[model samples]
Target: MLLPYAKPPPGDADHALLPPRSVPARSRTGEGFYMVRLLKSALVLFIGLHALFYALQNIANIDAAHGALAYVLSGADHAAYPATMFFKTGNPLLAWAALAVVLAGELAVAFFGIKGGWDLFAARSGTAEEFHAAKRSGVIAAGLALLVWFGFFMSFGAAFFQMWQTPLGTGSMEGAFMYAMASAITMLFVSATDD
Candidate 1:
């Protein structure tokens, strides 16, 4: 029932929704907004720098890196596991191929992470949409990090090569795990909506 003096409801009011003229709450615009964006960028930058340095190190010490890869691939000192696993090889060509893959992956991660961080930093003062859009590179970098550390090192090196049996391999696996987790955490953090 409607009062005689009451006005009629909106013709398009088929559902209980906010009025078209209503203003949304100020969630994205705040003092903490820039800080959040900066933090995300900084985290990604750190990851990028880490990869860059690692790649540089490997390149600078190519002989050592090659030897390490050879040691792990050959499964030479794995006394406990008498049975040999597949892909175990002492071929220099294979060692070089593995190293090349690692270097390439690391460089890719570095490139994307650095670019993403820069993009996010540049868009810090812009609209929320812009900042969100800047996260694409960061996301790609995180994926590369996972592919390199988790997929290549952990799965192929540690498991397939039985690298865990050797001291050097154990050290390498630990480092790889750390890098993987760092990238994952950064990705999750960066993906979060800024409010």
Candidate 2:
């Protein structure tokens, strides 16, 4: 029996009898929650800034940049590797078009990744739910980078343009593979949600 204004102690059978009370679940910090957030924000921002600066610096050098593509086209002449025979027309304008496409994707990765990191950092004090919500942009940004560097540069460039033949180019198979891997790992890390 309960007295007026007197509640039974928690864990008491009397307390249990009180219509199955509801309690909001407390947020779980678990291990390294903050550290994971820090890592995510920093890595994403680094990728974004790295790509942004590289693209911005190179955008002004269109002729030189386009010329790099010309070097790849030379692989078509390689008797040891006739991959370039896949080309219907090795027009210089088409080369510039490819470069433009790459630059656009880079700009997007830069913008989305940086902005996503910023969003995560800004929501640092928010609840775990808010933090999870903030990851959407970062995920999209990282995916975009993976798609461009891995899907486009490595896949299309290697398969279509014979990018693997380059000895010193960053878009060479080796370098593109590295960039793609980095973006993929970052994307996976950023996509993690509290379990």
Candidate 3:
């Protein structure tokens, strides 16, 4: 005995169908992109602040003769050691080389951060293909920035060790270690946001 009406299987032509799943609203996507941009902006602002602080510290330490080294050496402690961690009395070339390395790292970090911000913004608004491309670019830029910062952070220990070995100063290596640790914390935050 056949029922008066029998329901067709889902795949049957007679079966009613639901509409295809819709992509998330554009507004939602835009909001996500905006949040990422906001984060990148904050990171850039932090870098600027760090740069300003470094510049101010250097300027404040300049001597009356407008000689930076003179002012630094006048101080009775780590102040006298060459910025590159070399002893002023030991080897001038080593001091210069260290300074150059530090400066180069700083410059690279600044450039990478700026480029990363732009790339992140682009990835946020772009199509899937474009987003992936931008993501790769941003990751590289960010990785370079991290590398530069880490190099300087590690150098702090060497600088402090040089200071300790030289007659330039007497202090525990705790300060240098602490600084490196703090920097690591900042790097961790930056990396976490990248994901």
Q: How close to the true structure is residue 28 of candidate 1, measured as C-alpha lDDT? A: 42
Any idea what lDDT model 2 has? 0.74
Q: Residue 94's C-alpha lDDT in candidate 3?
A: 49
Of candidates 3 and 1, the better by lDDT:
1
**If scored against the real structure, what TM-score would every candidate get?**
0.84, 0.78, 0.49
* Whole-structure CA lDDT of model 3: 0.45
The TM-score, computed over Cα atoms with residue i paired to residue i, of candidate 2 is: 0.78
For model 1, residues 54-153, the per-residue Cα lDDT tens digits are: 9999999999999999899888899878476475788989999999999999999999999988988888777767778989998899999999999999
Q: What is the clash count for each candidate, in the order shown?
A: 0, 0, 0
Output the lDDT of residue 192, model 1: 71
lDDT of 3 by residue, 53-150 (tens): 54355345533213322222233245444354343333444444544554555455455555655665655544545544544433443444445444
Per-prediction CA RMSD (Å): 6.8, 4.9, 8.1
List runs of model 1 lying over 4 Å from the truth: 1-28
What lDDT does the true structure give each of the candidates? 0.87, 0.74, 0.45
Per-residue error for 56 in candidate 1, Å, reads 0.4
lDDT of 2 by residue, 1-195 (tens): 955665567767556545765432223564466667778888888778867976887688878878877666545444446544566346788778878888998899899889888988877656778878888778888888888888877777777766665564434667768877888888887776641
